[model samples]
Target: MTPTTIRHACIAALACAAMSASAHGLKPMSDDELSEVSGQALLSLTNQTYDGLDFTRITLGADIQLSANLSKVRLGEYSYTARNGTGADIDMGLFRFGRSDGTEAQRTVNITDPYFEFVYKNAADASKREVIGMRLGFGSIAGDLGVQLNAISGSLLINGGAAGNYDSHNDPLGGKRWDGTTCTSTCGLTLSQIGQLTAGDASGASRDFFISVLRQAVNFPGVNAATGAPDKALEGFWMNWRDRLYAPVLNAAPPPNLPKPPG
Candidate 1:
């Protein structure tokens, strides 16, 4: 063929290839396709795990349209429950991860919701740090140590041994003393006992303090006390802080107010 003719042929072929690509949408690399290219099918690729029994795969026809409804059908999973005496199918596409061989991986997509979200950036975010510091200050004041003067007095007095007195008479700044009882005998009370005696001051005040500190550090608005839990607005902040700080500390610390619950 002449040079001009060959150039025209190449242009037409390129256009056809582009149109084909656009029409099919991008086909994600399935296990087989991934194995072919990468030489291994990496299960749990999304750093998530699931029981193998929960997942099933259905192949899709090449001609299926790329609309949302069609995509949902392609990713749907069947559900059966004995209790309901009914079988229902759920859209598996709602699940961002899927399992094969009991291992889960994130769906290959441009956007996905991570099962565990971590915000490393918030750690260095200056505004977050300032907010957290302020929150911690409030938390400290409202906490057991700050609110329960009796507990503080008890702890201090008991630690002071024979010198323990409530009068604060002879020694102005010195520890208080109890005239009827000597604290030296009972001074060895466990930390849990101390916590219990102070518990009435604020139910989960210590925990709230820690949570507040974290919220301030990450620039999260205050938590809703009425909800008895962190609010949804703090979800992202909590997710990030928990992964980075809270989880690790809780794992390391002895159970809060521990020594086992009273029988």
Candidate 2:
């Protein structure tokens, strides 16, 4: 059967399976069980595509703790860009499922490189360092940079060498300067940390700032999965920040557009 037909068949099968599971006295599992089941489902879904095609990679049980009330799940795909830069596309799929037990199951398929990989860390001094490193590599947070800063700004600042300023003598990677003063290895400043320094009611504000910056830097449109509608706030923030910070990178000469001569 053609790939499309197979995909349709798989969807139908999954629907039937779901119904059967519900009918069988199979009570809903806990969050952990649900996560495992959903992860397995997603893998099955991926394999079903193109006659059991294997994925380049699969990251199972990735944790995305958005909040006490929300749960997140993710899947990723990896592939080379097309030779001509015209048809090559990578897939990065994300699934956000709500959870009451701090554990939930979700699934995705045909995902390329995801725009973001949200990670949760324990609340400790060591964890703070880990978060700081992530922020530097991934850019800022998504929603709380105010009207002035956005995701792109955060990305450029972080990946584009903004964090370097925090380092001694402006080293992009924090390292001890020649003079011997150690750079701030733990540069992460949480909302509580910020509140201690600043005055306003900035509870969780640091996280918001980080999210806004990351969204801007990543250039993600924040499309609604159900309706595929553009998230206005996210789009505007990305565009505005891109123009200011990432424009130079975007406008820079692309690698010679040499496509492998029609194989």
Candidate 3:
């Protein structure tokens, strides 16, 4: 082919291509059409069914650092058996997580993939459906925790008590820490009454921490307040979501307990 003819043909082809591209620039999809499309997101939601229950789980794909403090906290106040007839499932004067420092990373609790799971019973039948339980959880966590328990219904277990750690100065019932020498007369309580508590997991990683509040009343076996006998009492159900809780010393002493519960 001649050079002139080849050049002319190339110019015509380029013009045709530009015209076709302009004719089909872009078009917006309608709402109906867009609904058919699928996409991925940083957060995912899923529904699962197992054992006659339905669960909706929301998972996040990110890390979080949190430093929180609650001066006065109360949950499930319906009974009048605990804390000298205070009638609370869990009541605390102070609750704190993590620590504050000049650096933000150092001051915050490290958490990964925070999630919320909602559980329902008879989900398919709305008339008979009910929310059985819901929970907020972390895939993993590493942080510091401090708490001042004024009143509680469930039992708490702490490890390693070597006397001098528990006393009855703040207790109204004239409680005393048991010393071997005092076995002749006065009975004293130990720092930990529920025995040693295990925290974290077998792999030594602190993971799967969650707090669950159930609709049903769960029985917590504990010493009877009136008879001091081993008995199980039904109270609002609550689940713990921490590694371990250290006992705070009373009376504002060195290494004192968290601030007192708000009146």
All candidates in order of TM-score, best leading: 3, 2, 1
TM-score of each: 0.15, 0.17, 0.51
In model 3, the runs with Cα more than 4 Å from the true position are 1-40, 82-85, 101-106, 123-128, 152-205, 217-237, 242-263
Question: What does candidate 2's lDDT look like per residue over 1-263, in tens digits?
Answer: 99999999999999999999889966767888666763223221111111111112122322232311111211111245422111111111111212122212211111212223232233457434122111111111221110111001122112123222211123232111111122234332111111001101223111111122222212222212322312222211121111111111221221121222454
Best by lDDT: 3
| Separate clash counts for every candidate | 10, 19, 2
lDDT of each: 0.23, 0.23, 0.49
Q: Write the per-residue lDDT of candidate 3 for residues 133-207, one digit (tens) a residue.
A: 676666666655455554543332332234323323223432211111232222233322322222333444355
Give the deviation of candidate 3 from the true structure as CA RMSD.
13.7
Tens-digit lDDT track of model 1 for 89-176: 1111121111111211111111111111112232356555222221121121111110111111111211212333222122221212
TM-score of 2: 0.17
Instruction: By lDDT, rank the candidates, best first.
Output: 3, 1, 2
Alpha carbon RMSD to native, model 1: 26.2
* Model 2 misplacement above 4 A: 1-155, 158-235, 239-252
